[model samples]
Target: MQIIIVGCGKVGSTLAEQLSREDNDVTVLDINGQRVEQLVNELDIMGYIGSGISFDTLMEAGVKKADLLIAVTGSDELNLMCCLIAKKAGDCLTIARVRNPEYSRETEFLKKELGLAMVINPELTAAGEAARVLRLPTAISVEVFAKGKVEVLKFRIKPDSPLCRMEIQEIGPKLKSDILVCVVERGGEIIIPNGTFVLQERDNVYVAGAQKKRRNFLSVSASAPDR
Candidate 1:
């Protein structure tokens, strides 16, 4: 995909590098000449020095031929303007990073009004994920899907925990809970465990199931007395 990214701060440069690595033709625009030059040399992608809201700069960055344009400028308003112009000029899919909490609440309105393909609020997303993890403190990390009806959790096995030396097949019967053990990370190696696979101490286990069921399983398993 031919991609144009506006802004050269940490997020913009990192996005350029990753997209370029994925074989996308990425062109970045930033008013900072040093930033533009540095990313151009480091990532071997095109860079333009100009304001992203300028139509001339968008054209110079090949926005007309771009498959996608991502605007992540420091200012929410500037990012929105860049996407608006890119959509008008290129008719390409557009994404904008809108961080201001006030603007964040009107994401749907902004997307509909601006013809945006996506409105990315990184701060809001990070906060939501952090809240999910905090809600399930027993898990090392937590990811929710299906509107929080389902969840995937990762937790490490400690020596005295009931799950430390348990077999995958025993969890449902022993713990009286139904959950899918998806992946296990043990000693720097990843394993897709089978029914008979035994879990060991320090192994990082990933489980997925209905949110309530998974939460119950974690609570019951966590209640086992330490030896």
Candidate 2:
């Protein structure tokens, strides 16, 4: 995939490095010549020194041939402009990092009006994730995907829990829940669980399912006392 990253700050540089590592052709741009040079040297990815919103700069960055454009400049408005211009100049998928609280409520509006593929607000997302984890005390962490409809939750198994001695295949029938046990972390080893895999106490389990279903499953798995 050909990806153009606008800005040479932490986010942009990190994206460029990760994308390049994944075998994508990544080009990074920024007004700061030094930052661009550092990224190009460190990541071995292409770099351009110029404002992202400039038409000539984007053209020089090969936006026309880019599969995607990501804008993470310090200024929220600048990032938006970068994405908008990239969309018009290249017709590529655009993702903008808009972090201002003032624009938080308008993210949906911006996405629709600007035809943006995604609008990311890192602070807002982190706060939401932290809140989700706090709400689910049994969960070590909570991650949402598929537009928040699906969730992956990590929680530890307790000694007295029914799940401790249960096989992966028995969870659905015994617990009467639809959640899938996707991964298990036991004794510092990560395992992709199969039906015959018997869960042990102190194991960290990662489960994925719809919100309501997973909550129901967790309630049963974590809230029960010893028989």
Candidate 3:
């Protein structure tokens, strides 16, 4: 995809590098000439030094022919303006990085009004991730799906865990819960365990199911005495 990223800061540069690695034609724009030069030197991508909201700068960055325009400028308003201009000037998808908490609440409204493809609030996303991890303290990571109705949790089995020697088939019945063990990482190997597959100590497990059921399972697991 031919993409134009407006902002050469950490987030912008990281996006450019990743997209470039995936063979996307990426062009980054920023007011800082040195940052642009640094990214251009480090990555196989183009860098332009200019304000993201400037029509001429965006045109010069080939926004007309681009497949996507990502506005990640420091200012939320500037990011929105960049996306608005991109929509009016080109038939491309626009994504804006909006960090302001106030603006984050109206993301859907802003997308509808400005025709943005996505509005990403990194701070809000990070907070949500942290909250999910905190809710399940034993989980290394937690991901929600199905409109937050389903959860996928990653956790490791301790050496003294009752689940250490349990077979996959026994988990649901023993815990009196319904959940799917999706993946198991043991001894640096990944396995999609079947019913007969046995869990071991230090095995990192990924489980997915309805959010309530998963929480129930976790609650029981946390209170289970080592046997």
Candidate 4:
């Protein structure tokens, strides 16, 4: 994948580094010569120091042949303009970051006029994830899949928990429920085990099952320690 990223701030540099690490051909653009030079020194990427909204600047950054174009400039207007121009120049998947709460709101006018594939509000997404974790502190993390029909639950076993000594066969049947533990992380190793695998203390367990049975499974297995 060839990716063109505009804006070389902390987030932009980090994104470029990660994409480059994944072996994607990445090009980054920023108006600051220092920023472009620093990113060039830090990561294996092609970089251009110019305004993202300029056609010549973006073309030099290889936007015309880009598979993905991400514009995350500080101003919402600049980001929008970058996306629009990138979209018009070529058939690239475009993503724009909009900070203003009002500009991000979807309306008939926006959906019709703006060729925006997606708009991201980083602050809102982070806040929502934080709120979910705060409420479900018992679970190390949570991810919903299968259109919300299934939930992937992660929680670590405590030293004193009796279930640590049990095997999957014993635990699944004994619970009098349908949830099954799918993955286990112990000593920094992850395992996809069968019924024969025995769980141990301090192992982070990931369970996947129907969402309807999730509460019952968590209530019997593990809990978050009070702060």
Candidate 5:
């Protein structure tokens, strides 16, 4: 896909580098010439040095032919304006980062009018992630998808747990509920397990299933012995 990104900050530059590495045609725009030079040297993407809200700059970045346009400048106004211009001028899929609390609340209304595909709130996203960890410290992480009905649950085996040395197949017969442990993490590698997989102490498990089934599944772990 051809993508154009506005701003050259840490997040924007990182996004550019990843897209470029995937062999996507990418172009990055920034107001500062020095930042543009830095992006050119650090990423394989083309760099345009000018205000992203300007038509000339966006045109030079090849926004007209872009499949995606992302505006992530520090200024909310700049991001919104760039997205609006990209939609009006290029009809591309546009995503803008707007941190103002008010804009976030009215995303539905604004998205319809502005032709925006998404609005990202980095702080709010981080806060929600932290809250999930606080609720399930025994699990390294949790992710909900399929409109919050399907879930991905991560758990670490305590060295002293009775099932620490058991094979994955033994859990179905030993446990009272239904849950599928889809992946395992040993050291830093992620493993897709088969029936022969044996879980060791400190092994991280990634389970996926329906939300209610998965919630009840976690209750059987050593962390919930009192339940």
Candidate 6:
């Protein structure tokens, strides 16, 4: 895929690097000449030094032939304008990084009016993640899937915990909850554990299940007496 990224800051440069590594043709555009040069030197991807909202600059960056355009400039309005222009000029799929909370609420409206494929707000996403972690304090990370009906949680096994040295097969019978252990990370290695797999202390465990079952499992696990 051919992708054009606007801005040379952390997010834009990181996306460029990752997309380039994935064998995608990536072109980075920014008004800062030095930043564009640095990224070009480091990543060997195409770089354009100009305002992203300008038609001439975008045309020079081959926006007409690009498959996707991502605008992640510091200014939300500028990013939106870039996407708007990209949509008009190339009719390509466009993504914008809009950080302002006020604009976040109007995401659907903006997408409808401006023809944006996606609007990403990093701060809002981080806040949601923090809230999820706060709700489940024992979890290192919590990811919701299937529109909140399912969840994948990561947590470490504490020493002397009931889960320590327990076989995966015993969890359903002992805890009386249905949860699937998806991955276990221990000693710098990752394992897809089977029912017979025994969990050791300090192992990072990832489990996935329906929301109600996961909640029940966590509640039971948290209330279990250390053995």
Assess the local accuracy of residue 208 in candidate 5 as a C-alpha lDDT between 0 and 100: 78
TM-score of each: 0.85, 0.78, 0.90, 0.78, 0.80, 0.82
Q: After superposition, how far is residue 100 of candidate 4 from its true place, in Å?
A: 3.6
Candidate 4 on 1-227: residue-level lDDT in tens? 99998999877888999999999998999899899898988896788989989988887778778999988878888988998888888889888888787886663345357677778878877876787566556788888677445668888887766577888888767876687788998898989989989988888898877655766677777655433
- CA lDDT, every prediction? 0.90, 0.89, 0.88, 0.81, 0.83, 0.90
lDDT of 1 by residue, 8-51 (tens): 99999889999999999999999999999999999998999999
Model 4: per-residue Cα lDDT at residue 38: 89
* Ten residues in sequence with the least summed lDDT for candidate 6: 218-227
TM-score of 6: 0.82
- lDDT by residue (1-227, candidate 5, tens digit) is 99998988988988998999999998999988898898898775688889989998898889889999999899988999999998988979999998899988998887899999998888878887888666665566789777556668787787776558888788877875577888898999989998779898887788876655666567666642221
Better of 2 and 5 by lDDT: 2
lDDT of 3 by residue, 100-123 (tens): 999988989999999999999888
lDDT of 2 at 1: 92
Q: Could you tell me the lDDT of residue 160 within candidate 2? A: 79
Candidate maximizing TM-score = 3
Better of 4 and 6 by TM-score: 6
**Candidate 5 residue spans exceeding 4 A from truth:** 165-202, 208-220, 223-227
**For candidate 2, lDDT tens digit of each residue in 11-108?**
88888888999999999999999999999999898999999989999999999999999999999999999999998998799999999888878988
Candidate 4: Cα lDDT at 42: 85
Worst 10 residues of 1 by lDDT: 218-227
* Residue 146 in candidate 2, Cα distance off native in Å: 4.7
